[model samples]
Target chain A: MTNEEIRDFIQTAIAENRVMLFMKGTPEQPACGFSMRTSAALNALGVQYAALDILPDPRIRQELSAISNWPTIPQLFVDGELVGGCDIVTEMYESGELAQRVGVEQPQHEPEPPTAEAPQSAPLGVENRLS
Target chain B: MPTATELKERIESALPGSEANVEDLTGGGDHFRAEIVSDRFAGLSRIEQHRLVYDVFGTEIGGPIHALSLKTTTPEGQR
Candidate 1:
């Protein structure tokens, strides 16, 4: 697809999904540390989200940044709004705002600090239909 | 390769009355973490506040600057 088409595709994906993530790789096998931690936050919250891997096409990243005006990857969009990248997402998750925004109860158990490694528990029904 | 000092200077100069503490996270000069406090950030969402800092770098963000982890707060909100 051309750059214009890719941008449209990204915009549509964001509009269609209640919670959308544009990341470097799939949630199960993230290619970047930041992407891993961002997905982990959504996973830990048990929020079902649709994720798109931007690694497959450079244009996807280019157009995604254009559409979101966010320079980084692992961008989380809630209800068609940019929630932010890993740092903001992680901060919100730790503060319970992420769960609140996604309409989920913040898990009572303390979550281990986000590391490069994927969380041990499997993500709850993460949909990768955007690929 | 931009140094931590350069990043700090850029941010401080770009946003008047801002205090920025920048650290090279990996000692690689590319990845950094910056904590910024400025009245300019007042009433802005986290996304908007980060974008203000990001606009200072433009295309350089994903290019020469690989990553810039940010923590921003208004002067009154600083903890």
Candidate 2:
């Protein structure tokens, strides 16, 4: 597809999905730490969202940035507007604002806040299991 | 591979009157975490506030500067 077509595709996706995520990988298996955290936040909130993996094509990332004016991947869009990248999403998730925006109940159990450390711990836990 | 200090200087210089604390999260000089406080962010949404900082970097953000995690706030106590 031409660059123009790619941009059109992205714009349409944003307009169609109430909550859209343009990330490095799929929601089930995020390739980057930031992408993982962003997806986890949406998952924790239990909101339905459509995710597009930008890693498949460099142009996808380029076109996305062109449309959103956001430089990074793992950008979340709510109601066709840019919500933000990982930091903003995680902050909002913890503060209950994300839930309000999505119109869902923030989980009552208050799951552990997603942190950069959470991803690092997985490898350490794996090493410990091998020992 | 911009150092944390460089990132700090750039952000501070660009925003003027903004306080930016930057740390090289990986120590590799590519990934960084920055917390910024500025009057310039007073009336902006979180997204717009971040964009102000991001605009300073232009294309360097995802280029030489791999990732820049940010937390922006207004000096007036708004987040």
Candidate 3:
């Protein structure tokens, strides 16, 4: 496939998938501790979503970073839009916003205090061990 | 390198009383594996369950802690 075609293919993957997280690891193995947290947040929400692991190829990550300008793993995409990073998801969760976006309930019925979360910090903007 | 205790504490502090096991899976001080059980996951789907764990760490996910994998179960677990 031509370069443009390849790019289009990737775009299709993003656009067609309702929930996409371009993470470093799989849902079962998050490859990074932060990714694990992000993965957990989504799981807690109780939504069926697609997960793409960017660990298989350096070029895949490189191309995605170049195309999206997101220099980090665990990049989340909802309805094909780049929905910030891990911190962003956490923030949305606290505000009862991400649940709305993803079409699920807050699931915060736990007896413990709802420390839920709010977009904290994503090592995304930090220096990284580039793949 | 974060000890298993530190990892467990950090995870518990974030999610609270959540039945989780945080271990240094790689002995690299960075790689971790967390298997959590909680009522908070009662009705949520599989993907959603995983996201909650990642949300706690936020971006620190790929930072000081390099890799993290997860397995989440409801208080009742699989049917």
lDDT of each: 0.86, 0.84, 0.66
lDDT of 1 by residue, B2-69 (tens): 99999999999999899999999999899999999999988888999999999999999999999999
Candidate 3 regions off by >4 Å? A1-6, A110-131, B1-79
lDDT of 2 by residue, A1-131 (tens): 78888887888888988988888766667899999899888877777888788886788888899889999988999999999999999999999999999898988868588533223112100011100
Best prediction by DockQ:
1
For every candidate in turn, the CA RMSD to the true structure comes to: 2.5, 7.5, 13.3
Alpha-carbon interface RMSD for all candidates, in angstroms: 0.4, 0.4, 7.8
lDDT of 2 at B17: 95
Reference-based TM-score of each model: 0.91, 0.90, 0.51
Candidate 1 — which residues are off by over 4 angstroms?
Answer: A114-131
Model 3 per-residue lDDT tens digits across residues A1-131: 34455455567768877877777676666776556666667776767677767775566665776676554577777887776566556656666777899888777664222232432222222112233
Clash statistics: count for each candidate = 0, 0, 42
lDDT tens digits, residue span A2-69, model 1: 67777777888889889988888778888888999899888787778888888877888888898889
DockQ of candidate model 1: 0.92
Residue lDDT tens for model 2, B1-79: 6999999999999999999999999899999999999999987999999999999999999999999999998887797
